[model samples]
Target: MIRGRITGSVVSTRKLINLVGSKFMEVEYLRGGVSESLIAVDLVGAGIGEEVLVVTGSSSLRALEKDAPADAVIVGIID
Candidate 1:
């Protein structure tokens, strides 16, 4: 899992059939010294500016119920 902050969002009206009803967020990973950003599918209803826990690879696929062709997904939001 990667700890990150949701910095923004991605709105796509036209997506793959498998990704039709998913929400996308822009996250900046908060570990290490490097700041890396990625677009993540939001499985936990995380919003911009929230700290979130993200899962990647095959876990991302399961988190979103396989509706995700997503490589990264927000699995939890941290307070």
Candidate 2:
């Protein structure tokens, strides 16, 4: 899992059927001295500015609904 903060959100009205009901958020992760953000499907409810845990690849795919087509997923929010 990767640690990141919720930066924004994504709205897709024409996404795949499997992903239609899922909420997507932008999360920023630090790499070296720089930080980058990516869109992650929300597995847990996370608000902007909140620290969260992200899962990617096969683990993310398995954590979501069957055949969710998610490359990344926000699994948890940190206090």
Candidate 3:
């Protein structure tokens, strides 16, 4: 899991069938003190500027409870 924060949202007019209803967010994570960003599917309801926990790889598919073309997903919102 990666610790990150939701910076913004992504709007797609077209996407894979499996990801049609998913909400995407731009997440910023710290890597060696350098900031990096990735687009993540939101499983939990997380808003901008919120701290979140993101899972990648197969874990992202599991979080969606189905097969998706997603490589990253927001699993939890940090307090």
Candidate 4:
């Protein structure tokens, strides 16, 4: 799992059928103290600037449907 902050949101008019109802968020994570960003499927409703826990790879897909085609997913929102 990776800890990151929700930097923004992604607007998609069309996406894969499995991802139709999923919300997407832009997350900013630190790597070697340098910031990097990635779009993650939001399983937990996280707002902009909120801290969140993210899962990647197969774990991310498991967090959603059987095969969500997602590389990242927001699993938790930090208080």
The model with the greatest TM-score is 2
- Candidate 4 is scored at a TM of 0.91
lDDT of each: 0.85, 0.89, 0.90, 0.89
Candidate maximizing lDDT: 3
Q: Model 2 Cα RMSD, Å?
A: 0.9
Give a tens-digit lDDT track for model 3, residues 1-79.
9999999999998877888888999999999999999999998889999999999887677667566788999999987
| Residue 16 of model 3, lDDT score | 79
Expressed as tens digits, the lDDT of each residue in 1-79 for candidate 4 is 8899998999998788878888999999999999999999998778999999999887676778876688999999987
Q: Which stretches of candidate 2 lie over 4 Å from their true place?
A: none
Count residue pairs with overlapping backbones in model 2: 0
Q: By summed lDDT, which 10 consecutive residues of candidate 3 come out lowest? A: 58-67
Candidate 2 collision pairs: none
C-alpha positional error of residue 10 in candidate 4 after TM-score superposition, expressed in Å: 0.4
User: TM-score of predicted model 3?
Assistant: 0.92
Q: Write the per-residue lDDT of candidate 2 for residues 2-78, one digit (tens) a residue.
A: 89999899898988899889999999999886988889998788899999999977778788888789889998898
Estimate candidate 1's alpha-carbon lDDT, on a 0 to 1 scale: 0.85
Candidate order, lDDT descending: 3, 2, 4, 1
Against the hidden reference, what TM-scores do the models get? 0.87, 0.93, 0.92, 0.91
Question: What local lDDT score does residue 17 receive in model 1, on the 0 to 100 scale?
Answer: 88
Residue 66 shift from truth in candidate 3, angstroms: 2.3
User: Cα RMSD for candidate 1?
Assistant: 1.5
Lowest lDDT 10-residue stretch of candidate 1: 59-68
